[model samples]
Target: MTSQSVTPASAPASAEPKVNWTILLLGFAGMVIGQFMAILDIQIVASSLPQIQAGVGASADEISWIQTAYLIPEVVMIPLSGYLSRLWGTQKVFLLSCSGFILMSVAVGLSGSVEQMIFFRAVQGFVGGAMIPTVFAVAFTAFPPAQRVTASVIMGLIVTLAPTIGPTLGGHLTEQMSWRWLFFINVPPGMLVLFLVSRYANFDKGDPSLSKGFDWFGLVLMATFLMSLQFVLEEGAKNDWFADDEILLLSVVTLVTGPLFIWRTLTYYNPIVELRAFANRNFFVGVVMTFTVGLALFGGTFLLPLFLGRVRGYSAAEVGTTMVVSGLAMFATGPFAGRLVRLVDPRVLMFGGFMMCAWGMWDAHAVTDQWGFWEFAGVQALRGVGVMIAMIASQQVTMSTLPPHMVKNASGLVNLFRNVGGAVGLALLNTSLTTNTALHMSELTQNIQNTNAGMQGMLAAMQERFADSVDPAGAAMKAINGMLLKQATTLAFGDAFAMLAIGCAFAAFVTLLAKPVKQQPGAPPVASDAH
Candidate 1:
C-alpha cells in the first residue's frame, strides 16, 4: 500500500482532514524537542554528579538510583508506545506524554532530598520513554510513504544531534546555573510543543488496536528481566559479581522472566510490540545493528567522561566540552548524509560508518597517560561523524524496507533492541575491563626485569609517595601496585573501545545485506517536508 499523504489547502475547514503543513512542522519540532529532554538526561546527570551528590548528600549508589529510576520508567514504557498510541490518538498520547515529562522533571528539580528526587525521576522516565517512541510513530506516519526515507534522515539527524548536544547544553547550564536548571530547561520548549500538538496532529487517526487492557503478565516478565539486568551492570563490581546474592537473584529473574515475556508477546492477539515485525528481513537485521549501535552509544556515553575524570583528571565541564566535537561533526555530516542516502544505498553508508566508528574507537584505544587533550578530542570527532552516517542511513533503510502499515511496528522493535543493547553493552564492557585489568597487571609486573639503581630509586620514590596509604615499607611495594592499577584501567578502556570497534564492524557487515531501495520518483535520500 502507498504511504498516507496529507494536503491542507484542498480540504474543507470542517473536515480538518489533515493538519496544515505549517502546524504539522510545529508538531514535529515539538516531538524532536521532547525527545531531546529524555536522551540528554542519560549523561547530563553524570556531569552534575558532584554537585548533585553534595546537594542531597547522596552516595554513588543513591545517585545511581536517581538515574536508574528515570531509566526504568522509560524502558518499560517505550515498547508499549506503538500499542498505546494506537489506543489513544497520537496527539493525545504525545501531548499527554510531553506534559507528564515536563511535570515530572519539574518535580525532580524541586525535590528536597535524594528519596524525593529518585521517586520523581522514575516518574519522569515513564513519560520520557513514551515521549521518544511516539515521536518516531508520529514522524513516520505523518509524512507520505514516498517521503519516509527523507523523513527518516531528518529524524536520524535530530536523534543523533539531540543527545550529542545534551552534554554541551548540560555543561553550560550546570556550570552557569544550578543543576535544577538542567531539568528546568525543558519547560518553555515543551509548552510550545503542547500548543502545536493541539493545532496539527490528527490524534483522531490513532491506531485502533489498543482497546485491550494492560498486559500485566508481559509487563511483569519484561520489567523483571530488564530492570534486573540493569542492576547487575551498574552494581556488579560493588556486589562482587555472581557470588553476590543480589546478582544471583537477578539471574534467576532474567532466566524466568525473559523467555516468558517473549512467549506472551508472540502469543497475544495484540502484543504490545507486535512481535511479528521481526519477520521482515530488513527490520530483523536493523534490530541487530540497533543492538550493537546501542551498546556503543551507551558504553561510550558512560566511559569517556569517567575515563577523563578518573584517569586524566579533567573536570565535568572540560569533559563535556571535549565531547561536543563528536556531536558537531555529526551535525555537519547529517545534511550530506541525507543527500547521500538517496544517491548511495544505505548499505554503503551503514558499512562505511561502521568501519569508521571502529577505526575511531581503535584511535581512542591508543590514548596514553601523556597524551594531550587534543588527541582524545580528535578521535571523538571522527567517531561523531561516523555515528551520523551509520545511524541516519540505518534508520531510513530499516523503515523504508517495511510496508507502510508496519512502520510503527518496525520503530517499536528497533527501540526495544537498542535499549537492550545499551544495557548489555555497558555490562559487557565493564566485565571485559575488569578482566583486562588483571591480565595487564600480570604482564606489567613481568616486564620489570631491570634491577638497576635508577629504576630502583624511581620505584623507591614511588614507594615513598604511597607510604601513607599502605605501610612504611609497604609503600614501595604498593607504589608499583598503584601504577599497575592505573595501567590496568587504561588497558581495559582500550580493550573496550577495540571490542566496540570490532562489534560495530560486524554490525556494518550485517547491514550490507540490506537491498538497495529503488528510489521513488522525486524522492531525495533525506527529505523532511516538515510543514
Candidate 2:
C-alpha cells in the first residue's frame, strides 16, 4: 500500500481532512516500540559486555569489536535509509528492518564464536539503523501540524530515555540470568510492534523506477567515510589516537573519503542523501543545536554510569535507578514543554534547556564517594528538563521550516547529525577523563612525600585504623593511593561536566540566529494527507 504524503503549506485551505486519531496512535505506538528497541540494543550490550566476552571467549581487543561492529554499520546505513525507503515504502522497510533486527538478535545470542557475533551484529546495525530515521520521518506525517510538537515531545523522551534505562535492565538480566537474555528480551516487544505495524501501517509505495538512477559512487563514498570515521572515533581513545598504526590508517581513510562523500552528495543528481537540507537557515542552526543535544545526552549518560559504577561503588542496577529520575522528570514535564513549544518562541526553550543542563552538570561537580540517590536524582531531574526542552524544540524548529517533500530525506540527516555528535562527544569525554585522571593523580601524589610529617602521621593513623591487616604499612599506603585516584577521577569528571556546560552555552547562543517559521494562524488541524 502506498503511504499518504503530508500536505505542503502551499496546499489550498479546504484540501485538508479532519484529524484521524486512531491511525496516528497506532503509528505512534509502532514507531516508539521500534525506535526504543533500536536505541536500547546498544546500551544493553554495552552494560553486559564483560559477561558477553566470557560467554564468547573474546579478549579485550575482540570485545571492543562487538560495539564497533554494530556502530560502524549503524552510522553508515542511517543516511542511506531515506533512499531505501523511497525505493520501496516506509512501512515495508520498517517491517523488514524489525524482522531483521529480531532475527539478528537471536543469532547474536546463539553465536558460539566472536566472528559470528560480529557478523550478526553488523547486519543488525544496518537493519536497525534505518528504523530510527524512518520512525522519525513518520512522526511528522502521522500527527497534524497542530499536535506535531506534542508528538515530538513524546518521541524525544523515548529517544533520550531508552539508553538510560537499557543499562539497568541489562544489569538486572545479566546478573540474574544468562547474558544471552539481553537479546532474547526483545522478542515479546518486537512481536507486539510487528503486529501493530502489519495491522495499522499503510504508506504510499515508492517509485521503484527511481532505483535505476541511484548514485552508486556516492553510496560507496558515504559508506566508506562513515565506517572509517566510526572506527576512528570508537578506537581512538583506546589506541591513544594517531599513535597507533590502525587508527592512523583509518583516520587517513576517513579524511579522504569524507570530503569525497560530501562532494558527491552536492554534485550528484538525486544523491543518496539530500544534502540540500543544510541550505535551509533553520535546519542549519537546528543541526548544530541537535549536535549539542546528542553530546550532552550521550556524554552525560556515559559519565553518570561510569562514576557510579566505578568510583561510587554502585552496581549496574543502582546506576540505572539513579538515572531513571531524569526520565521521570522528562515525562512529568513533557506535555508542558510541548505546550510551550506551541506558544513561546522555541528559541526561548532552546536557551532554557541548555541552561538547565549546564546547571545540572555544574551541580554534579561536587560528587564524591559519599554521594548517593538524593544527590544525583535532583541533578538528573534538572538535566531531564533540559533534554525535553532542547530536543523537542530543536526537532520542531528544524523540520518545520522545511517543505513537506524534504522531510523524508531530512529525517535521516537529523538522526545522522545526532549520532555523529554522540560518537564524537563520547570519544572526547573518554580521552579527557583518562588524561585528566593521570594529571590529577600526579599532582596529588606530590603531596604524599615520606619526608613530610603530616603525610607520615596520616599514614600512621590509617594503619592504626586497619590494624587487622597483616601488612599495615602496605595496606595504609594502598588505601591512601586508592583514595587519591578516586579523588582524581572525580575531578576529571567535574572537568568533563564543565566542558559540556560550555558547549551547551554555545548551542543556546546559536539558537538566537535561527529565524522563526511562520505558520498560518487559525489553520484547521487535520490528519496527515495521502499522496
Candidate 3:
C-alpha cells in the first residue's frame, strides 16, 4: 500500500515571535517531568514485582501480568497519541493525560487484589504513554533551532536516565517503605506538571474540525495490531515462542491485523498515523538508529540485573546500587554530549557512540562468575555514555529534519520504533540464553567422563569434604553437577553479551550511512527531501 503525502494547513512562522523564556522553559520543564514519570514507570516495578505479587495474592504466573497489562496498552497509546494531540492540541491532551495518569497512580497504589491492580495499571499506562512522545514533539516545535541542542540533551538524559535508574529507585523505595510507594511517588511531581503546563504551554491550537472525518475503524485496527504485537513480544520468551497456544494465537492476530491496519491507514482520507514522513530518507535512517539504541538500552538493563540476581545472588538493593554507576556516567556525560553534537558532525558522534556500546558489550562478553560491581562498573559507564550520545544525535536527525507540521506524527512513530526494537531484542536475547545454556550443559557433560583422571580427583576431593555425610559419594556427585550447571550458565551469559557486542558493532558501521543534519539559528529545518 502506498501512502499519500499530508499537507499542513499552515506553514511554519516566517519570523521569530517575541519569546517568553521563563514561561516557555517552565512549561517545557513540566512536560519533561511528565515524560520522565511515564517512562520510569515502565521499569520501576520490575525489581519489586515479587512484593506486588505477594501483596495482591497473585500466583507466580499471574504476577507477570502486572507488567504485561501496563505494557500492552502503553504501546497501543504511543502511536495513537499523535492523532490525539493533533485533535485536542498539545496542552489539552497533555493535561488530560497527566490528570488521568495521576488518578490511576493512586488507584494502582490502593488496589487490593490482582484484578484491581491489573485494571488500574492498564489505565495508568494508556495515559502515561501519551506524555512520552508529546515531549519529543514539543522539544522540536517549542524551542528555536539555536537552543535545540540543549533541549535535545535534556530529553536524551531523561529518556536514558529514567529507565536506567528505575530499578535502583524502586528497590530502595520498596525496601524502605512498601511496594505502594512506587505508584504514590508520581503524585506530587505529576500535580506540579499539571499546574505549570496548564498555565503556560500554549504551543498550538486544536483542530476540532479534524474530528469530522475521524476513522474509528482505523483506530480499532491499530490498537488491535499494536496490543497483539506487544503481547506476543512480551510473553513469547516465557511461553517458548510459537509453541505455546496463546503465543500462537496472538502471533496470528498480530499478522492478520498488522497488514489490515497499514492498508486502512494508507487508504483512509484522514489516516490516524502519518506514514508519509517515512518517505524522507534521513528520518528513515534516524528511526533505524533509534531502534538499535533501544535494543542496546533496554537489552543491557534487562541482562545485567538478571545476571546479578541469578548468578551472583545479589539482593535487589545491591543490584540497584551496583547499577547506579551507569546512571551517574550518563548524568556526567550529558552536558559534554550536548556541546559535542553542536561542534562535530552528528553522524560522527553516532558512530563513536555505537562503537563505545560495542566496546562495553565486548568487555562484558568476557564476564566470569566472580564478576561484581567493580568489574561491571567500566562496562556500565561505557554503555551509559554510548547510549546517551547516540540517542541525542538520533533524536535530532529524526525530528529536526521533518517539517514543523509533521513533527508531531513523526515523534510518535520514532519513539514506537525504539520500543519495538527493545521488545524484539529482549525476546531474542532471552531465547538465546536458554538455548545456549542447554547446549553448553550437554557438551560439558559429555566431555567429562566418570573415568577421567581429573573428574576422579575432583570427586575424591568432594567426597573427602563430605566424609561425615551418610552418602558422601552421592553428595560429592550432586556438588559436581551443581558446579557444572553454574559454569554452563555463566558461559551462556558471556554468549549473550557477545551477541549484543556484535549487534552494536554492525550498527556503528551503519551509522555512517546517514546524511548529516545542520541546524541554523533562525531558519526552518534543512532536509534532503520532504514532499
Candidate 4:
C-alpha cells in the first residue's frame, strides 16, 4: 500500500500535508520546548544532589532515589504514551502532561522531606516522559518532507543537548541560587510552552472508541515489567547486582514478568505498546543505531563528569564547566548536520558519525588526573558532532519509511530502545569502573614490593616529605597506597573509554547493513528495497 493509504482519515490529510506553516511551526516549537524541559530535568540534579540531600535531610543512599524514582516511572510511561495519545488525542495528552508536569515541578521544589521529594519526582517523571515521544511523533508526522531535516536537527539537538548541559546548568543554578531552583526553573518556560501549544497544536483527534477493549491487564503487566526492569538496571550496580536481597527479588520479578508481558502484548486484542513495529527491517536497524547512540551519548556524558570529579578533584561547577564543551560543539554542529542529512546518504552520515564518536572515545583512553577543559575539548567536540549527526540519521532511518499511521507507535518504540540502551550502558560502565579499579589495585599492590628500587625510591621520597611527623614511615606507606589507588582508578577509566570506543567502531560497521536512503527533489527520502 502507498503511504497515504494507511493514514487515518481523521488524521492530517497527508504525511506532508499542505497546512498553515505559521501555526504548526509555533505549536511544534512549543512542544519542542516542553520536551527540552522534561529531558533537562532528568540530569539537572546530577551535579546538585548533595545540596538537595542536605535540604531534604536525606542520607547519602536516600539521595540517589531522587533520580532513580524519576527514571523508573519515566521509562514505564514512554512506550505507553503512543496508546495514550491515540486514545486521548495528541493535543489533550500534551496539554495534560504539560500541566501535570508543571504542578509536580512545583511540588518537588516545595518538598520538605526526602519522601515528599521522591513522590513528587516520580509523578513529574511520568507526566514529563509523555512529552518526549510525543515530540518525536509530531516532528516526523506534522512537518512536510522538506522541513523534516530541520525538524530532525532541532529534535536531535534538544535530545542530546539537554542532558549534556543539564549538570552544568544545575551546578550554576545551585551555586548562584539554591538547589530548589532546579525544579522551579522549569516553570517560566513551561508556562510559555503550555500557552503556545494549547492555542496552536491542532494535529490529530483522538478516537475514544479505541479504549473499548483496552487491555487493562496488559497495561498492568507492561508497567510491572518495565518498572521492575528499570529498578534492576538503575540500582543493580550500586547494590552489587543480584547479590543484594532486594535486587535479587526484583530481578526475579523482571525475569518472570518480562516474557509474560511480551506474550500478552502480542496476544492481546489491543496492546499497550506496539511490538509489531520491530517487524519492519529498516525500523529495526534504525532502532539498533539509536540504541548505540544512547550508549555513546549517555555513556560519554556519564564518564567525563565522573573522571573529572573523582580523579581531578573538581567541584560540581568545575565539572560542569569542563563538560560544556560538548554541548557547544553539538549546538554548533546541529544546523550543519541538518543540512548535510538531505545531501548525503543517511547511512553514510551514520557511519561517519559513529566513527567520529569512536575516535573521540579512543582519544579519551589517554585520560589522566591532570586532564581538564582544554584536554577534553577536542574529544568532547568530536562526540558532540558525532552524536548529533548519528542521531539525525538514525531518526530518519527509523521513521522515514514507516506509514504515517505507524509513526506514533513506532516513535514510542524508538525512544524506548534508546532509553533502555542508556540504562544498560550506564550499568555496564559502572560495573566496569568498579571491577576494573579493584582488579588494577590488586595487581598494582602485588607488583609494588620492598625489594623494588622504584617502590623504595617513592617510599623514601614520601618519608622525606613527611620528615617532621612522628610516624613518617606510616605516613609514607599511606601516601604510597593513595597514589596507587589513584593510578588504578585512572587506568580503569581508560579501560572504560576503550571499551566505548570499540562499541562505537562496531556500530559504524553496522551502519552499512541499513538500506541507503535516497531523497528525491520534492519528496521524502525513500528506503531502497534492494536489500
Q: RMSD (Cα, Å) of candidate 3?
A: 6.1
**Model 2 Cα shift for residue 376 (angstroms):** 0.8
| Residue-level lDDT tens digits of model 3 in 20-101 | 7788899999999999999899888878888898899999888988888888898878898998899999999999999999
Ranking by TM-score: 4, 3, 2, 1
| TM-score: the better of candidates 1 and 4 | 4
Backbone clash pairs for candidate 4 read none
Candidate models: Cα lDDT each? 0.74, 0.83, 0.88, 0.89
Best by lDDT: 4
- What ranking emerges by lDDT with the best candidate at the front? 4, 3, 2, 1
RMSD of each: 4.2, 4.1, 6.1, 4.7
Assess every candidate by TM-score: 0.89, 0.93, 0.93, 0.94
Which runs in model 2 stand beyond 4 Å of their true positions? 1-13, 462-472, 520-531
lDDT value, candidate 1, whole model: 0.74
Give the C-alpha lDDT of model 3. Answer: 0.88
On residues 241-311, what C-alpha lDDT tens digit does candidate 2 reach at each position?
Answer: 99999999999999999999999988887789988988999999999988889888888887888888778
